[model samples]
Target: MPEYGPLHGETVIFTGTLKSLEVFDLVRQYGGVPVSIPLIQVNEVEEPTDEKRMKTCSDFDWLIFTSQNAVKAFQSKMERFAISVNEIPCKIAAVGTRTAAALEKIGFTVEFIPTVFSADVFVKQFKPTDGELNVLFLKGSLAGSIIREELPFQVVEWTVYETGAKRDSINSLVDLLKSRRDCSVLFASPSAVRVFSEDAVPSVGWSGYTIGAIGHVTERALLEAGATVDVKPEIYTLKELVETLSNRKDEFR
Candidate 1:
């Protein structure tokens, strides 16, 4: 008989807005079942100002992206405006490896990524050349104002996407919690945590299932909602989160 790992026979649930095949395969590789029930929905915002702002991409000294959604939305806007990636003269900075990978996929070389995948760390660590620099931050509607408020340089923000709770997934999530006690729920974003707490927690409560959070931000959200976090990776990526969960599977049992 083949020896089974700690994650053997575990049912892992993903509650992020976006589903990744890579993340799913990681769970399966560790002998766990991966379920996708998104708790949030992210959509690009369409406005007349999109083209105007995108046209000014070259005017900025640096372009910043904190989320993969921002990168995806930026690419979409660029395509819509018939603007090639080579046309943008500004160097790009991403907060996390996944965000940087997304930018790199679109042919933008990532110039900076913080040691820690957070805005506060990025602002504290990022050192620019001695000059008046203009940074344009492409972000979602729900993104925090840390970059704009904390950075000393002139920072302009462009809202690329809007995130909202996926109310349709509420019932499914509640049912999962009610029926399964041995499952592990993975939360990638605070928005997903908020939705899970607001819509599903009241029905099934926030206990019994193993909880995994991707980063400190999501872990903080889970804590604020009175949920216990059992798994959190040192690195804030989905792959790392799954690996951490797999390594700590014995603890949950």
Candidate 2:
């Protein structure tokens, strides 16, 4: 057998979508088993009915995306409507580095990013259009109201996706975790933490497990849920969280 890593015999419950297999591979590389039980699911709407028309058809001046899901949803919607990239008339702004990179991956250039990667900072840095301020916001159903409340401009929202509880194989997952000596959960978003905590029954030995939240928002949710968070990554990404857990093996142990 090969040598075991510091995380040998450990297990990690991943609560995010499998957008990529990076999280699973990282956990295994660190000698921890990865158990995926995504607490939230995002489904892109096949069409934008409320927004009614393509953003290029409106007098939209700016397009904003907060998460990679929002960016991917926008791209998927645009493609559905046959709206080509060259046809987009407005500039794009993204909240986080990953969001910006996602936009670039779809051949859309990001024009603005705040100094910090939070909705508050992005809202404060947002510049409004001169007249009517027709800005387009690509949003998820469960998205926070900060963008709507803080916008100085008139916002046209295209809710391209809906995010909700995604629970399956919960009993089996609980059994799997119960067998592990050092089990930790990884939470990428606040909603993920909320859904998992609220749905988890009291019979489950939640107290025995450790939690890892990706950012302050998720950390707040974990705190509110009364879950003992073992690790929280400063960078607020899945890869960073896995790497941080690998480095600080004692924390989870």
Candidate 3:
């Protein structure tokens, strides 16, 4: 399977909030050198109230989860407010496989997962609500505006979690990852890319390195931060990222 699963012996650096142990295992399974340094710290937002949740649970036409962090933060807020998943009286939609899995684990059957993992594609693919579709987004602090801008549905956003750079972890990660022209640093979000680009610039420049982004948003973030992205999957899912790396003939080039 070397021709197909060719990530063996490759050093991959990961930086994100979820502590992607599953991704690490997947990398190892594909024979990659899995190095994960979580640089984005996730903190729950304390502002959501029972009144707001009560309105949200019963009012929205569709409740959309964009990330696993969103699902997790929503669960924590719901539990604190004594809200139940079954009480969310709307159709549920998740963006990625992991996001769908997280919701499923918490007893919510995901009603829709778009054919392509892009928010733009999801906006086009998902069947709208009967009348006006009001989407409640469980999102992080520095999330991109693709969903709000691109979707035809009315979006109500709740910042369920805050994402910030874990500089101590990033500094230490930079020490280990410097001068890795042959290595690929995989970024999953704009925040992670923001952190890495700011912190890792002192020791190494990304001009000669191979950078892998999870999606267009992340790719734009990396480019805006002056990092050259070399690889991204056909689909934006984490599993597909590894597969894309495995399948690419010259991933490190």
Candidate 4:
């Protein structure tokens, strides 16, 4: 087990997509107890509309994927269209390592990736060519436009997946937080923070536990919901978050 200090003996709760368990195991190795309470469920929306599919593939100079869910959903749509990932002509960009890994798994090489895996950094790096650099953004329906709003290119947004709060799971998280005196909560997205805060804010008093946010947006959401943020990783990835917490375990102790 890898050693981490500041997180030693802390109980951490995860509330988002558990695409990979590497982060969870790292937390435990660093002496932090990891708890997974999924607050948002991802559902794929697949309907064969030629107009939308054609526009996604043909009209875009750059295809941007923000999440792994988007990659999977887009891949599924591409299969329906009889389009292969290797055959695509446009440049591919992924917001984070996870999404980039998904693209790599599907045989598509990512041409652009930001240092920090956020829309702000991505927009800073995005240089649109003249004469309508059509960009196809594959992301969740509820995702905010930190990238879309700032891009100089002609952006076409597509909701490849929908995110909704898991209401039943909220009670369990509240109960766990209430019972445990020393525990931390992890928020991966602004939506998860919003959903969890809507009910969890009133149910569990915020003073006893630590809150870990993945990025600036998530931290802002957590703060807006009246919860104090204890940890936020500089890099916007789960692996980095776990590692940073592991390395700085003594701070929380």
Top candidate when judged by lDDT against the true structure: 1
Q: What are the runs in model 3 whose C-alpha is more than 4 Å off?
A: 1-5, 48-55, 179-181, 249-253
- Encode model 4's per-residue lDDT on 1-253: one tens digit a residue: 4464566667888899799888888787777788889999998886667436754585578899888989888877777777876567788999998899999998898988888888878899877554678888888989888767888877878888998988788899999888877787888998888888787878776778777889997888888888888778998888777766655556535
Expressed as tens digits, the lDDT of each residue in 174-210 for candidate 3 is 7666644456788898888877777787667775556
Among these predictions, the greatest TM-score belongs to 1
Off by over 4 Å in 2: 47-52, 55-58, 127-133, 250-253
Q: What is candidate 1's lDDT per residue for 147-166, written digit by digit as tens?
A: 99999999999899999988
lDDT of 2 by residue, 111-217 (tens): 99876677877899877445666778888888888888888887767677889887774566667666767877788888877777766634464587767888777
Q: Give the 10-residue window scoring lowest on summed lDDT in candidate 1.
A: 1-10
What's each prediction's TM-score? 0.96, 0.88, 0.87, 0.90
After TM-score superposition, the amount by which residue 131's alpha carbon in candidate 3 deviates from its true location, in angstroms, is 1.4
> How does candidate 3 fare on TM-score?
0.87
Q: Point out where model 4 deviates above 4 Å.
A: 1-6, 50-56, 128-131
- Give all candidates' CA lDDT scores: 0.88, 0.77, 0.77, 0.81
In angstroms, the error of model 4 at 90 is 1.0
